[model samples]
Target chain A: MDALRITHVEGTALPMRGEDVDTDRIMPARFLRAVTFEGLEQHVFEDERSGSVAGDRAKEQHPFDNPQYAGASILLVNRNFGCGSSREHAPQGLRRWGIRAVVGESFSEIFFGNSVMIGLPCVTVSPDELHELMERVEERPSAVLRIDLTAGTCEIDGFTCAIGLPAAARDALVTGAWDTTGLLLARYEEVNAVAATLPYVAGF
Target chain B: MGKTLLQKVWDAHAVRILPTGQTQLFIGLHLIHEVTTPQAFDALRARGWKVSRPDRTFGTVDHIVPTRERNRPFLDLLAEDMITALEKNCHDFGIRLAGLGDDRQGIVHVIGPELGLTQPGMTIACGDSHTSTHGAFGAVAFGIGTSQVRDVLASQCLAIEPLKVRRIKVDGVLPRGVYAKDVILAIIQKLGVGGGVGYAYEYAGSAIDRMSMDERMTICNMSIEGGARVGYVNPDQTTFDYLKGRPFAPEGEAFERAKAWWASMASDADARYDDEVVIRAEELTPLVTWGVNPGQSIGVGGRIPSVDASLPDQQAVADALAYMGLEGGKPIAGMRVDVAFIGSCTNSRLSDLREAARIVKGRHVAPHVKGLVVPGSVAVKRAAEREGLDEIFRTAGFEWRDAGCSMCLGMNPDKLVGDQVCATSSNRNFKGRQGSPTGRTLLMSPAMVAAAAVAGEVVDVRELSAEVAAGAI
Candidate 1:
């Protein structure tokens, strides 16, 4: 993990508009069969789109079938995004799917943790500001959605929109401290001191 | 203040204090399952570590081990690899593994108590979240993450923050048909999901004290759903009676010593609490959730909250209403059900099955709905079948399956097909959590699921119970 560095990669924003979008929709449990955690980009949102074949033709039945937000990365969800199970695979599925970060009005607590743990930056914009961004995404599929972690803003068609993140999470993203094993390792002395007084632990 | 059970266990287990003001606690018992233990065991091996306290640890295979078929190497290749790795690891580390076909094979939580491993005045930690189920015997139990799992495997101490204690007292008595499942669901509704985020809840009051060991386990099982890491009832005579002749429980002279020790763990009558709330058991009703979250619930006779009710969580309510295709203020009961599942680590014990069987005996499941009853453990399965409850379930159109988290989170073969709406006895009701992303789960009691299975609708279990009481069946 690099020391707190943020790089902005401009991409084709594939926005899937919906509410209460859950983890199972993000990654089908069947795909969980493959070991080594690779070859998953094709399966992200399997239940949502039947298959993860990227396309632009709009269909009315499925929520992701909205014409305006095809091939979008920065998902502009309505509210209470990812309100479901604590499966870490949810955010892993999103990252594998070409989605960089979510700019939703709010996120479920477990989803937020899953996102942060897997290095997918989830930036929360105010509901009103988020509404404006979603409107722009819905208004123009080709419009650019720029999320700058350093700037703490998302730009829709060069129009800047503010978002907020907790300082620890923000710093972690800005300075690439992805793995937290070091934090625990650094406290070896402190942890051992506490462990010394216990007997059962001596067996471990 | 005199020591409450919480304080006694907390003090006895306190290893050291960290600068963060949390106590470094020693875990007397550690349980590992196949799902979360592989990574942890790998971490230990990578560090050239041996399991520090193999005697204090027990391993079980349940999550991926299908209750349907326990054949060699497993049907799922990944599950087979998991079991293989776990078997190799346990052999290498000298830790006993309760592999499938072993009498001890069952959900980690269920096997612990049945074997008398979940003793009072001990601090227990496991990688699985429902570890609080062991706390019914007055142990201080909490679920740890994988990293923590590795830590416990390598070193038996957990660097943890001490939680503030809160007392919840339920007075009087519960009305007929209001089981422990309803009580936990009701608690989640009243407290919101996050109300107990940082507190260890001490369930007090007369109702708790009067409950059997099985009943208390149900209440503590959903402590995590309420955002509390730990929930427990004080050890009383009921607890002692239940422990009398278990395999691991002390015997003869040792039993008296153990009894005295267990007695010390109960909270002093005047023990202090950080917060206190009381509920009247008489006021509780059979409860059910109308949404994905456990907190979105109402009593059996109650109507759903209106989106216009001015609650701050209204959007959540709205989302739930929309997902369920329900209009706000509608009654949760009488809704059509396509499936009914009665199993989970949460409520698939012998008592739970017996209660469900009482409702389904001589009755038939609605033609349109499917029903199943999966026991929590092999012991539970054996006991249930010995009593012929399994035949009763089969006779009523309910499938009798072996033990595991079947239909609980849909990790195994049992799952909801398509968009079927299921009345489930599991702990969670998240979207697609029951196997189909579009599938919906209505969390209720085993008895309630039984009632729904027979009626093909979410009927109040009380009405069915009243009829059963009157020998209408």
Candidate 2:
């Protein structure tokens, strides 16, 4: 795979206003039964969007259910989003649903790591700025939000806010160090050499 | 001037600093289970890569395995496919698999310690979030996603940033009936759910030091619920004693040398912490989560926390209260329960079973309350049955079953039917976490779950333990 470089992302924004949106709610445990993450986009927020109880998905009311937010590529969320479960499926589902970047007041550590690894840049903005941005995004649905990571700013029609990414994470996105799988594979011999000396490996 | 245990372990395992400034740390132990490993193994196959150190990796089948029906070709085709993929992947990769029917098979976290694979000073990684459960041994263990799991399978290392260590010190003695589960719940309640973000919690002080290895595991298992990526207790004599003569532990002289090294790896007496928070253990009571999140909890005798307009997460509190269908000021102890689950990687150990059995031995499960006890592993199952704990549960109208992560997230057959309210010993209380989207879960200790099963409502385990001791049944 080519090294990932995410310098900037520009798209219509989908706003989810809530604190501590957990992974279980992002992609319910029932949907996690699948062996692969394939076709999980349709099931994102399955419970909240469809109001399903047990495999029944008829009623629908959540914001994601609205056709207005269709094809939106930028996700706008509130504090401590993705706060529970270390399941990567949460990020994978969001990615599959076409989200390229997320601008939120805050993010859980694991969720941030998972999103960064998958080439989705999660930027943190001040709460006041986030609220202003969310209002602008919801009010002007036709307006495109531009998130320039290199410039460290999120801009829309009537709002512009400074966004923050950890320096190391930003470096990864800029230099393509985010996808280290190739780099890891390059050091195969060194890894095996270290493994050979460990007592547990030797004993086996 | 002294390094903390986390720093020492992290420094020892640092392979190099990556361009991203994340440490390319070597993983001493890599554990995998059925649910998360299939996609990871597939990722490796797609890259034409084989496991770098199969000898250092271990596999097991949990999450999707049925606890009651032990027969092959599981009724759920999806569950069967997942387990089969794990077995095939482990075999092809030359990794040891503790699959069903194997004596070593169990929850990845439980079996790692039981088989002596989880040792002090190790940097362990697993695909499951509860990997922190092994931190009870003083190891630096963290959960990884499937992609990271694939990374570990290919290179036996992870590129990760270091975490600041927060020392959470709980002093004094814990009152009777308050288990480690209650201690963690209380901590999460006091410190909001997101309080531990970007930090590794080092549980310390007299209270933590006095806890058994099992209790420490129970405390660390729920670190994720508090938004901490990892939580641990320093390895002590108790940790070494628990590992003594286990199936894979060091032998005789080697054991002595390993113990010395492990003891030396403990954080220094004068180690400086980034932050410290102290709690009086004597003041703690049995805790139960009152809302959808684990942090929204109250003591057994306490009422739900009223939503304060001054609180930052007011909307969050309101949302949780709505999802739970609970009034803010109502008492939690008498809340009705439709089901009671006494299992999970958190509280399905031998001691957990013994304590719950002590409360359930001569009692009948309340009518209309479905109770179930799933041991953490096959060995735990056999051990419980050997000690008649299984009999106690079965006779009390509880389904005493084989080992798997049953009803905890409910990937298997054991799930909450419809909007049933369950008193559970599992770690998470997230909405629909028990499989049914509308099902409600109350997180508590195993013995507390037993009390709920008997009373058909949440009750103080201390009250039941007192009654049982008084021989009033």
Candidate 3:
């Protein structure tokens, strides 16, 4: 994979309000049965939005199902958004569902790491700022929300709030340095040299 | 101040600090299963990358393998394709695979410890979240994404941020009926679901010290549910004794040297911690999930929590109640169950089966409920059969089947039908986690699940244990 840089994303916002929206809810386990994540877009939040399995026909109230947030490219969520299962499909499903970036109060450690590798940067803002951003987006669904990684800020119609990203994540997103696989390949000699001395590896 | 066990293990594995400011840590062992590795291997092939350390990696088919049938060409075409893909990928990459027919084949977590592949003072990685299950051996094991799986395959290292260590001590003796599963459930319930974020939990104290190797594994397996990316128990005599004489463990003089090194990996008496919490083990009871999340649990005979703003997060509680189709403030013991499942990485070991069999013998499943028992691994299955545990289950009207992760997360054919409420021994009680989007899962211990299977409703396992002891069955 080539180094991919993500300096900024400007798109409409899909607002979701909940704490600890785990990965299992993000992409249900049944969808994980597929060979690949190709058709995951239709299944993102399948249980929350569709109620297809239960046939409740109530049209579960959720932001993703709202026509106003139809093509939104950025997702705005509350604290601990991806809290369960370490499956990469949580982010993959979101990315497949047209989510290019996530702005939240906090994210689970594994979810954040998975997003970073896929070039989807997850930024954090204060509760006050998040409330303001959500209100602004909900008021005008079509308003352009800008998330600039280089500037560490989110802007909506001249209203800007400081966003926080780890310095390392920011540097990697800006300089297209997130491809750790290439770095590992370049250090092949070092890895083998280290592996040779380990008893477990030798036993194998 | 002395460093904790987590720091000592992490520092030993740290290769260097990369330009991105992430630590380039070497992974000593890489475990893979059929469900997560296909995409990873494809990505590696797309990049024309060869596995840098195939010798250190092991493969198995667990998640999608049917627990009821041992025949090939699975009834589920998609599951069959996944198995074939994993087999081809392992062969092409020179990775050793413990396929269905292999004696070693089983859940990735169970086979690792039984084969003695899991050791102290090592870094382990796998595509499955239960990789934390391996941390019970004192290694820092992490569950990686498919992309990271590709990363490990090509480089045998992962770029990660260092985590703070929180020491959790559970002092005093455990009650007679409370097992390791109950201990972990109680801890997660008290700490909330997201309490351990950005921290590695170091389990200790008298309770953890007295636990057997299998019991320790059950505690560590669900660390992910508590929001901790990794959880570990410091290696000691118990850990060493469990690994000794196993298939992959060091032998003879080498074993002595290995034991000495492993003993040195425990946290020092004066080790510092980023945070600390203590609980008295005697105060714990057999706990079960009352709602969607693992943290939304109460004691077996306790009432379901009333969802309101006064709770930790009222919105979450309300949402959980709504998803679970349950009313608040009701007794949890009388909830009806349509199915009962016992088996998963969490509580599918020999000891777990033995305890469940003891409760189930001379009893029969409730007419309204369907009961199934899937062992963790082939070895566990054979061991259970030799002890007539399978016969006990079958005679009690429980379906005795092959070994795999059955009814756990609904990855295979073993799944709950729509709207079915299942009493389960597996971890995670999330809505629709048992296959059907509307299916309900109540997480409990194996003994509790067995009791529910016969009662057709949630009942206190202790009550059943007492009856079994008095020959009431």
Candidate 4:
């Protein structure tokens, strides 16, 4: 696990292009057996790079090759970003593929929840803000997008925008916390307390 | 003043209703798969806890298992290890698992119902979204995350928030060409994807009542698309008849004892609901999604809505259109597609494939398209193969692969390429859902997708009535 410090990178907006990019495309379905997130970065867009699945040999530049948007990590995508089967590898692939966070106009609820649970910042931005961010990335590829979850702002060039995440989700991302352990530890108490009120829990 | 069916079930299963408006409900049946169980079992072992009810739990080898070859030392090392781990877990815990080569070995949802293990009035939980498919038998089934998977294994119960019941009543008669796949697409269209969040959908009314057991499975399968944690239809004669002769079903005196019990679990005719959304069957048509979400849909024979929305009512319409690269008022039919998939828990039953095979009989695949037909379970595959549905699918240029989640989510080898459009029978038309980030998926019925494959584009099954009406096929 190559642990890198999240350096509060600026958020550049780009309405995620593509529909139904299931795990196979995100990290190739073949890599689901890869035990760990090691060496997954190279397989990010295996379909496009290998020209194996659905190839357009004539087209020189697929979406991933746009020179202006090189090295940008925070992706702004359209609705239903991940809607296929529940393969954890899709998020792992994105996390390794330079996508520190995704600000989507909308997200598959499961994908969004899982991303947050695993420490990936997936926020829902208004459509206008989504479009503006995409326009910014297109206009200036070298332009840094200052995405600060601590400040609740995605600043690209001269524009500063708010990506509205529910406070609970926002707080978890800002503080670099995963509440899975705490939630699990508290379940016994929660169950007992509720059981006391209902009385049947004791019988069970 | 009235107890809805949901309330009745909730009360029956509730160990306690929590202050947070959730319930600590005991699960009657818990199903496990290969991928999600390892971590869950590890979590249990770390706590040194034993499985609470091994007899009530069942395991299966799917998701990670390779569909093609059936030998040891599997090509995918991680999958082989996961399979080995499950075998050990099931053996150690005294839980029964339907390993491959066993007749009962099939997709969790498909086998659960077929073996008569899935009973109405029970709560079924699995670490899979399509667990709702068992709801066709009136069982209250829900999908859980991995951690929740651990909880079920340890305690045979879940801490869950109570769901509001949305009585999604479909009335009148469906058109000749429309199937359950179309019914669900229409429902998602009427209610946005998140419309059913925090709710359980009770499928009712004349249209739903008229469907077969297979069709009911299709409707309940996509409840997740409506953002409902669970969706179900009340048990009726169709559910009873389907279970009567199955392997796991109780027989004779025991059957009589069970049926009487099952009957009592059906929603009372006057059951009240938290919310109700009604749609006339006549208003619905064979529908397909032209956008990234299932909600971005249009009726068969309709044109893709244009993205040029200069007004307010047209905003969502515009967003859908732009993302899909659809031109306003362009007919959805006859639009070119590169692939077609006919399978999923949603529509990979014998009847669904039979309908697709019936449509594609004596037809040649379009030179420009790639089509596939995967059955939902091994039983479904065997039944279809018995009827020689494989030959028809193969003869029509589709790859007749083994039963698994083939292309539904592209977890296995099935997927789409960049910008290539697919007419799929599986649920969800989200962006890149078929494998390529740029790949587009259009949700439709198996027959509709067959039509698209035959025509090399979206074509309404109603127009090509030759297969059903003309009998030329």
Error of 4 at B353 (Å): 1.7
Residue A143 CA displacement from its true place in model 1, Å: 12
Candidate 3: C-alpha lDDT: 0.89
Task: Give the CAPRI class of candidate 3.
Answer: medium
Error of 2 at A50 (Å): 3.0
For candidate 4 chain A, which ten residues in a row score worst on lDDT?
A195-204
Q: Which parts of model 2 are misplaced by more than 4 Å?
A: A1-3, A51-60, A188-204
DockQ of predicted candidate 2:
0.57
The DockQ-derived docking category for candidate 4 is incorrect
Residue A115, model 1, lDDT:
70
| Pairs that collide, model 3 | none
For residues A166-204, could you state the per-residue lDDT of candidate 3 as single tens digits? 988888788887766886677667667766666556552
In terms of docking quality, model 1 is incorrect
Q: Once model 3 is optimally superposed onto the true structure by TM-score, how far is the C-alpha of residue A152 displaced, in angstroms?
A: 1.2
- What lDDT does candidate 1 reach at residue A79? 53
What is candidate 3's DockQ? Answer: 0.64
Tell me what fraction of the real C-alpha contacts between chains A and B each candidate also makes. Answer: 0.06, 0.55, 0.62, 0.06
Cα shift from native, residue B435, model 3 (Å): 0.1
Q: Against the correct fold, how does model 2 do in TM-score? A: 0.97
Model 1 interface root-mean-square deviation: 5.6
lDDT of each residue in A66-121, candidate 1, tens digit only: 44555666666755566434445557667776677777766654466457656677
**Candidate 3 stretches greater than 4 Å from native:** A1-3, A51-60, A196-199
